[model samples]
Target: MPSFLGSLRQFVLAPKLSAVTFAERGFPGAGSAAAERLEAIPQAVVCGFEWGIAARDLWEVERRLELVEQEQRGFAYEGAAMAFTVRDAMAGGRGTRTRDLLLGPAAPHLLLAYIGIGFAMARLPRPLWRNIMPDLTGTLFYPTMTWLAVDGYGFDLAYFHPEKYIGKQRVPPPYPWEGRPDYFPRAVDQGIGRALWFTGGAEPETVTASVARFPSERRPDLWSGVGLAATFAGGASADGLARVRDAAGEHWPQLGLGAVFAISARVMAGHVPEHSALACEVLAGSSVDDAVAIAGRTGASPADADDTMPLYEQWRNRIRAELGAISGEQRKAS
Candidate 1:
């Protein structure tokens, strides 16, 4: 049997399994290729962090994030542009089967979950900081990473399976319903742009205003959520915010704060079906008290810990069993 620590390590180091599918399916175009590779980086980072925390080794998460950040910063501007083109192309059609082929059994559910979480997080009230902090920290990271996938690396629509859209090809379908169009593609891009904008040293208000004007179905919700989060966090430094805004505006001004929140929520909630099993296990085993404790340790306020504990315990046991089964299969194969 794998020790908890060993299992955690495996989870963290879980190779870019999704990328293998991308390569196998031959989704042509440089942007498509880049998107495929970029998608893996965040997954690897998140899985590593999740596993490390499970094993009580928090430093690993920091290390992984640092590595990811370095890589993201190093990607060239031209490369990022190519990625965007590919993403847009994929969004139009062409690679639907490629997306399906790569995603296999786990793609649909995972996509829906991400969409749900993103919308949910974006719509959250600003005053609910205590309730939303965990969701913010835990969920936001993934969507933030997705933004990087687009803006930083230029990943395109093929990465998201745009062929699933219904009607005029303008909007993504609603959750659990596969035919709807994605309503917030522009919003997602805008959120990414804003993050880059704020990181660049623009005034927060300027960046905030620019984000407000960017189009999105969830614009009001996203603006409110980001505004609240920024306010609560005391806001980023003016110079820093400007730097981010400058960079984002240069690449994808359409990406906005609300999309970022929504993406993060999706990532945290493990709405992605491929990741659901692991997400469920983590949530089940994790204590609201512990999450609150970790938040306090990180200089954040303590949040309500009463409601999620029972659910956490139940999921943890369920995950333990599932993990055991997977481990057994690995051993047999070996």
Candidate 2:
């Protein structure tokens, strides 16, 4: 049974935090405020991550999580994971539970669980993160905290669902009806991009070094991950983005593609992170309006695995086209 505060949190604050229009109305000191909140997220993620590491076993971890939730304060930055981390933290290190929640029929629950893992990652030392993830499926589809990027993207979409989809008051469920199993890798790619944003902190070199720890194939994913983070989290300077792109070598295109997605997502959401607009211009030679136009056409629906893949591809293609167009313009200008 859920605790009283936990139930109230899910039914009340979580929905509000996930609401489409919550962040649209910027507050005074909104930039600083957003940064502060973003910082807190990693703190929560690490706190939960550390607990998982110290636990004797899965049972112990879940028990400690529940105790912590009993005293959890209301929504931190209104992030879905912030309010619901405990629910997902309970499933940490349990392969069966993780699989059932993420890939099984109840996959809507996957977002919370992945975010919980981010929380777990936050607590674990940077070195241990590569080895400690719970292998839900037989394969490691989401290396590091890449899976959470799917949730990060989904949460933003769901938050704006009512406004974007019209008459959709409730945030859309995390799972689409036409679920695409193949989409997992792509989703993980997005998550890795998001992880880059968090892990990079104030330094692009930190991001580069962090990506270096992963296998070479993951380099593209890591570069793109940083791009996504810069788009939403908004701290990368032009010089910094350039350094990252140069460091990417063959993977530069992937990094640019990741930036396109992040920029588009932010535009469609009606909120661009501070400096993200500049980052977009510097990295993509594109404006937020371009992103809004491309992202606006996409819609959300519940679908099965078979149906979701094509849609994701279409979205990818749309962003790629925009990217190609921008590259052409930059070349012509030069």
Q: Specify the highest-TM-score model's number.
A: 2
Tens-digit lDDT track for model 2 on 3-93? Answer: 4554454453332322212133221222454345445443443344444333334454445444433212111111223223333444443
Candidate 1 local lDDT, 1-334, one digit each (tens): 3357556544653334454233332333223433344334334433432333233222332343234332221111112122222222333423232232113321222222222223223323323211211122343222222222212111122123323211112332222111112323433442343232222122455445544454544343233323222321222443433343343332221122222222333343233222222222222222233322332232211232233332222222233344344436757999
| C-alpha positional error of residue 37 in candidate 1 after TM-score superposition, expressed in Å | 6.8
Range of the 10 consecutive residues with the lowest summed lDDT in candidate 1: 149-158
Q: Which one is best on lDDT? A: 2
Estimate the Cα RMSD of every predicted model relative to the unseen true structure: 20.1, 14.3
Q: Candidate 1, which segments miss by more than 4 Å at Cα?
A: 1-21, 30-54, 67-69, 73-162, 165-334
